[model samples]
Target: MNQSAAFSPLHRLWHSRRFRGLVPPALLLVLWWLATTHEWVSPLVLVPFGQLYDAALDPQVFHSLAEGIASTFGRLLQGYGIGIGIGLALGVGMGLSKAFDRIMGPSFHAVRQVAILAWIPLLTAWFGTGDLCKIVFVAIAAAKPVVMGAFEGVRSTPAQLLEVGRVLGFSRLKMLRWVILPSSAPAIVTALQLSLIYSWFAAIGAEYVIGVMSGGIGSVVMGAQEHFRTDVVLLGVTLIAATGVAMNKGLRGLPDYLFRWRTRA
Candidate 1:
């Protein structure tokens, strides 16, 4: 083909959705290669992709990855379960009672503004560097989002529906079961997804700071830093990002599958 025909073919491919999805990553890799080649970043700081892949396949590398994944996921699940459970209960209470919302909301908001890292010193003192500390950190990270989501979901429930339930002589339990829970399901699920993601990041951060011999992914990142292995650091980072994406897919997929009716206006 002549230059014009070639240009047309390129345009068509560029406009294709699947091809478009690949372009940004392809461009980023190219940019990374060029940047590394030109010494735009120090070699110690930015390892080339080839080195990363090679190191990744080594048995030591595989072992570290496996250990890190297991440790991080374990702590995350523990904290996430506790945090979401408590948050949802508190949220329901706050949503139902104006007096409770008035009393608890300010304190809750104040605590939420404090970063999880800031709480590390006190938590470490109380819980030591054990699993409890890490679990607390994850819970702290996950709880706010869950509380906010659930609170909003419950509070924003339609007044008319609540009145209708009262007219039907529904007890408080029946009202919550029939009217509130179903109406709030989407928002609660959204909160769970957010809490889970926050918990994942929190577990890794806690591991990096407090964990020893636990073999969490965060610890792997820490080890990479200690050893000045930028290639391994990047690989750890890549794995975390990939895992987060996978978790998001699984969590969100269930709601989308089961509640297709909710999507309609």
Candidate 2:
């Protein structure tokens, strides 16, 4: 009975998603400790955990991190919402109307081929390196993936599904809400997930490049770099990476949840 009880807990832990996900981080922590302890790298490049911990405990550092995260998340959420909203509408129109597609699709494709960073100069020229510019840049980065995902998803909807919608006398709005969206739930979810990831990256990139001095997580890194604070830099980077991983994990099951009707049927 004791053996069975011990084995049961171990087996459950071994199979749990949280445990599986933690393995890589645990390994990384071990490696980081080994490297720092042995001075495998220059202290300037990688600081010891003790130093990192001390930096985190500092009141000023804590306040800066909190404010930085708040600023960054503010810009991220606003720009991301705007981007995905516009992108979804445009993509759906293109997929639903051949005339609209023919007119806009070519230009969109041509524009997409241009490197994202290349637009920074143009956008900066128009928006003038302020919050507006950073938000616009982040929006642009987020929109592309959403546009592509939504377009492809809608285009791929089965003809039979459309026929069923028509037979049921669904209006355009009804068809879209009931048949189109649900049919393309997986693709839409994928697009949204990718958009979120890209937006976070773009939010940081915009702050780093735009240099608006508005205070973001990117500013923390920039400040640390300017002052040669390796521990602070590591803290900022770890925070950014952790938030991104959490966002990705949180959205991983969305498609399954949204499309459960198919599974049940």
Candidate 3:
């Protein structure tokens, strides 16, 4: 057998998504273990798995982290709902009404151009460094993409489809339900995915910026950092990465699952 032929299966496996995905983390874990065992760096910087286990074993540490995650998730959901609700409504109006678009589009565009983080300070000042501030900031972060997604999606609906809806004597609401929304759903869905991810980012940022006194995963990390609890800090970092990744996977096709009717028309 030729050498290339003999190696083909192994080469293919190396490039496979599942294989590639597993390998980097496996390599990092191996490196982490090696570094810890050899004491390659200061223990204060890179905490060993033993210390991580010890931190996790502490009931106080474990519970605080858990509570923090729960609160963060709660705020994420609330703010996300408010943000997308208004964003979709406004986007639909703008898409359907030239006058509304003209009245609102410039301000919307101008506001979205500002970096999301820039709003944190103003939000914190206006709303106070509490759940209100955090939730509001997250809402702002979640709204922009959703607005654009829904706007473009609706605007891009083919003229033929609208004409068909008209020919069928569909009412405004029926036309929107059967023709406009279905046609624009893909873009809207993509925007939703983006909004969810950005909402999480905003949630964490707000927690960090507005003050952890309110309690959230950001608080967990910040509090641990203040005490120089490197092990707990490492644990918090791991949790953040895991949560973000889980969300990405969990909601990747969410619109398809939640709004199945949107695709059916």
Candidate 4:
């Protein structure tokens, strides 16, 4: 039960994929530092690694980044939560009832075909360039994948198992809770992950296009682009990529724990 024994080198190595993945980037960083040291690449375009790191540490930039990230993450989570909740509810409803599916499936598919970006103008008009607009974008992006995944998951629930559940006096709600939900959990997890990624992308696009005026990673990139500061842009891109990876890992943990029953199933 020793903590050190529990967290061995293998565990450390496994959990350190981010650090390991940084090797190549680290090498590239070294190369860039060397190039800048030697004045090989123009200092104006390719800022030195040290300077980039320094810029990131700058109080103004750091404060801006913190504010931007907090704002964007808040919006993203709000939209994603709404999307997941609604999609899951309706998906279960449609999957459980053939009449419901038949009634709404076509319209759902048709609307889902429309890109999230396509709704930007209307969303802006309705909600303005505020938190609500960003939420709308994130929700639209998150909803479709979740709905699709839920539809497939529910539709593919084993017919024989469902019949058995009905024969056992399982009510519809009981059946969904005990049978369908367990079976479709993996798909649901995948859908959630996809929804998160979609939300992330949608938020970025909305911020970029509408210019939220508030701080966000997208705002940082926009500012950098406006100032012709490619280095800052590169830094923003790197931060975004890093943050996405972290978020993906956080999401993977949820399914691993929630669907642990699958290991036996």
Candidate number with greatest lDDT: 3
Model 2 lowest lDDT segment of ten = 180-189
Each prediction's TM-score versus the true structure: 0.87, 0.87, 0.91, 0.83
Candidate number with the higher TM-score (3 or 4): 3
Q: Is candidate 2 or candidate 4 better by TM-score?
A: 2
lDDT of each: 0.87, 0.89, 0.91, 0.84
Compared with the true structure, what per-residue lDDT tens digits does model 2 show for residues 56-121?
999998888888989999999999999999899888889888899999999989988988789899
Lowest-lDDT window of 10 residues in candidate 1? 207-216
Candidate 1 achieves a global lDDT of 0.87
Over 104-190, each residue of candidate 4 has an lDDT whose tens digit, in order, gives 888998998897778988988898887788887898888888888887888889999899998999997899889999878788789
lDDT by residue (1-265, candidate 3, tens digit) is: 6999989999999889999889889999899999989999888778888889999999999999999999999999999999999899989889999999999999999998999989877887798898989888988989999999999999999999999999999999999999999989988989989999999999998887779899999999999999889999889888999999998998886877877875785
Mark the regions of model 3 whose C-alpha exceeds 4 Å error after superposition. 1-12, 255-265
- Order by TM-score, highest first: 3, 1, 2, 4
Query: In terms of TM-score, which candidate is strongest?
Result: 3
